[model samples]
Target: MAKKLGLKQKYQMMTRGLGWDTTYQSMDKVYPFDKFEGIKVHDWDAWEDPFRLTMDSYWKLQAEKERKLYAVIDSFAQNNGHLGISDPRYLNAVKLFIQGVSPLEYMAHRHFAHVARNIRGIGPAVAAQMQSLDELRHAQTQIHTISHYNKFFDGIHEWRHMHDRVWYLSVPKSFFDDAVTAGPFEFLTAISFSFEYLLTNLLFVPFMSGAAYNGDLATVTFGFSAQSDESRHMTLGLEVIKFLLEQDEANVPIIQRWLDKWFWRGYRLLTLVAMMMDYLLPKKIMSWQEAWEMYYEEAGGALFQDLARYGIKEPMSAAVARKEKNRLSSEAWAIFYQYTHAAAFHTWDIDEEHKAWLAEKYPETFDKLYRPRLDFWEKEAAAGRRFYNNALPQLCTVCQIPMGFTEPDDPTTICFRESEYKGEHYHFCSDGCKGIFDNEPEKYVQSWLPVHQIFQGNCGGASVEDVLKWYRMNLGADNLDFSGSPEDKFWSEWHRTASRAEAAE
Candidate 1:
């Protein structure tokens, strides 16, 4: 070889020289979508990608990761790995992954594609392009890794339809829809900064750790593979935040506002995940409170300190979020326990051992605020009358969760906020949601509230069964109480046969 090119020079050669000016066509006409958002970008050349990833290296490394991931997935299937899980209940975590999270990967891919096309800078555009490819890979790998479970599990089939039509699934769907529909700068701040940099570890780490703890080889493999890509995404997120802040002093307030809005939005969405980690996993890895403290409170606190130099402060609801972490998972599990009949996933009464675990994890609030209610329900379930809230629940206008969250301060009383816009009443679960609604009334007013659609004769018919049918639910299998369900019966028989074989041996 005559000479070897350095990484920085290669990146510059690949990215910088790809743009040119035209005397006949103005740059504004060429890049019309970038300017209208009131964002002041003084110098596009200042945008930098920290990863220094070129397309050739990106493809080579990604292909190697895929080869190894597929090898593990193949091994898992050949080894009858489903039987090796800690418990059948652990599959519920994977079910939620397929139904709730996998589609979001696809949505991220779409929005990042938009950003890559519309954003003006060469460096940022290249980074967005890489992230777009990463997201698409994540979606495919997640589906492929979990498809093995679909062969033997309920609630996993028809997940694509459920993601769009279900009541609870609306939480995540609405979140991404709001972000993708926003302007480019807002989308970057909302997703790249607020979601990826600030909150992604909270979402990804627990689920992956739970999978590893529960002997889910395929999910663990896929999770690690996706996480490798997430490190790059996190770098992109931090770079974009700093770039936007460094671009103009005026960009600070706008970014802070987006941070506040998306942080709360992402936190509310993660409540479902918190419940999954604490209540759904058979072999608990860590309590949701511990994970929150480790991921968000500790790491996120330091991040805000670093950003403080740039005039960025913590989100407005940071205090409330910290306080609520103690009770968030318990309250969320209680809602799911009661309304699981309307859900595709399964839930059952918490046994005494599990209750003891909860008490230890949430000593301050479990018995005082949440346990009494769970105890009463446990008693009712013992008497052969499992509780299921059949009536529709009012969803918050912005977050779209049921109006079941307690007041931030009291934790005993339900936190319900209402606003009147153009003589129309809109409901919210908390002050944060209410503030978001008040700021963006017109956008939220057009929300496709699932419960409201049921009452409007728009979602199937007025009956719960009709709506379930429309949701593509597998009745007596996917929905209703998990006690004595087919899955429970299968687990019982599986263990009994194993015992017999061991005794015979």
Candidate 2:
């Protein structure tokens, strides 16, 4: 036999063997999507495999992980891990995950599969194929992990249905929808580069840490399972960017524009995570402002500096986002508080204890700006007049967020950016969103705005109640304040009965 193959040699030989130039058809025909976006690649062979993982070895490693992961899941379920959480309110964050975030994993699966088929190089295509499988596994594992909570929780049961049509959910849904609809190169830049590389810690770390801090053993276990795959995906993100930049000098500006567009897009999409970290998790990991500073401000600053060698500067929205971080979570939470009557998950009416936390975390803004607003709502709730705004708010033509974000300079005034597309005036939440719309007016104009759809009699009916019914959400059980909801009452009753049993024993 020939000399036993070493690891790198095995990887190169095996990966290269996976793809061959088509005999019956030219590569232009086989990989039609490679050139349409104007991403010039002179040689497909230039793509260096980031990780040397073969399919057979990948399956074996993943199988072992799955076995360990399920054992932990079974143990958690048998131990009634749902009851062991820091608080019932903490599950609202979990509800948000299942409802808004988990479904994106499945979408990644579909599109990565598409990328694998359409990319020219064997190295990158094989990498994409593995990531597609990784995404599918993540989606399945998240459902299985969170399904334990569904037995007791109200909002999670209809995640897939709600992800497709719910008003607030359309934020993430639209983000991915735009990505998947783009050409393959743009998809890689958007999801793999911008999302997975630049902004993933903002999404993943906080959620995982919140689970651990909140006594969520099951979800923590799932996080442990996904850590390796997330690293691999992030590595692929960097590799894809560097590889594209090295291929052609002209691809630099094209890639830079994509970086700009997607940074803002990914930032807007992460508004949910900001709200979750600040408002939803009772035992908070860190304030959203702090996390942003640590993750994006410092870490991302360093990343962009590295890319400067390739003439890739930081995104245009970086300074704007840094300014808005001081205000992001507060504004996002305020919208949820106002619209909690129609929301699938419950939001608490901010009490003094919670207000104190907000004050401490957001000293500069909370006391001056957001505190008085919460005090008004708190006083109303105490006077048997809880404020609940059920009316649909105007949505940005691009980001789909309620038109609530304020000027970067002035936190008190609503920041509105407007553009006229083909004689029709459209609105945006920020310069970033307006810029996105200005670039692709045709695509942005066709956005499936839920508020607009509600007006046009498309989403179940004319009223919020009818729309909620169409969303398959139980009105009282799912919506309104978490403090005195049925879930809260049941938690107290269950614990009291358990206490009595222990006392007798």
Candidate 3:
């Protein structure tokens, strides 16, 4: 074998060295100027992607990864859902994970497809294409893997439509839509840099590791596959930021504002991920507090420190987010508990072990504030009936999560704030999401809250089963309504199989 080139070296050669032309070719002719903005680019060679794998090696690795991944997915499906340690109740976390993240992968595909087309430089453009394809693969593989769960549960169907139209779905949607609508440079800063490069480790790694812990092999595999691509995307983000900053001084403030807004926005969306990591996934990987401590508090803190030398200040709201991250896992878990009836997954009362974990992870404010609520819910659960509230809380017009989050420093009660524009009242979960809404209420107002959709008679039918059927959900016997329905047959059969396996063992 020849002496190996590192990823950085390959990236430098394929993307960075592409524009190293010595001959007198007019730079403007080579990189045509677009008059969308007044920014002038004197040299395009300054653009560089840090992770340097070219098309051939990129596709080869991705293909091999997918081959291995799909083999595991198929094997897991054939062997029944792989996590023996994970009870059905644990899938509530899975449902939320699929809901919050898988769809975003698809959105990444779409937006990256656009980015691949729009970027002016060939090297960056090609890299964008690789990322674009990677994202599309991620979306497909996620959906395929999760579709197995769809056969057994009711959570993931209609996610694309739900993403566009559902209320809670709006939290992520509004964040991405904002990035999509912004100018090209700002879009890069908003999505590629702040959201992907800086914060993605916080979002994906813990969950993947947790999936492994929880016996969710498929999810773990998919998470890893997507994350491998994320490193490249992060490189693109870093490159975009440096390239934009070096190109012109005026772009700094614009990039800075985009950084601030998207960082907070992306951070808020990761709240769902935090909850999933802490309370949703069985055999918890790492606490949100721990992940935040490592990823955001340590890695992000260092990155911001590094950027400080460039006059790129830390996001204005990062401190508040860091403070909230300490408490948001349990806080968000409460929201998930209150609302999971509407989700495809089921939520169980937080047990003693989980409570202990919470206490350890959140030393400052776990038992004193949140335990009482868990106790009450547990008591209600133990008393024969699991409390499944059907009432839909009014969703924020933008973020779409129910109005359950309280103001910072006061997590004891729900917080709801509204703004009036012309005639209509637009609701927001917090000042951050609210500020985003107020800045562009017209855009946020166009959101499709799924609860609102159900109320509006836009979904398929009057009954839950009809709605499920309408949404293309194919419920199996085990996942069928335990309340005496035909779908219960699957559960009966699964139980019978479990009985046989136990008896055999």
Top model number, lDDT? 2
Per-residue alpha-carbon lDDT of candidate 2 for residues 325-344, written as tens digits (9 for 90 to 100): 87899999889998988888
Return the top candidate by TM-score: 2
Error of 3 at 148 (Å): 3.5
- What ranges in model 3 sit over 4 Å off? 1-40, 81-85, 157-161, 384-386, 449-505
Task: Give the range where candidate 1 is weakest over 10 consecutive residues by summed lDDT.
Answer: 14-23
Candidate 1 residue spans exceeding 4 A from truth: 1-4, 22-24, 496-505
* Candidate 3 lDDT by residue in tens digits, 82-190: 3353655555556666666777777777877776666567677777778778878987998888888777655566666556554456677767777777655666777
Residue 253 in model 1: shift from native, Å?
0.9
Identify the superior model by lDDT, candidate 2 or candidate 3: 2
Clashes of each: 0, 0, 14
Error of 1 at 494 (Å): 3.5
RMSD of 3: 4.6
Which scores greater on TM-score, model 1 or model 3?
A: 1
Q: Which pairs in model 2 have colliding backbones?
A: none
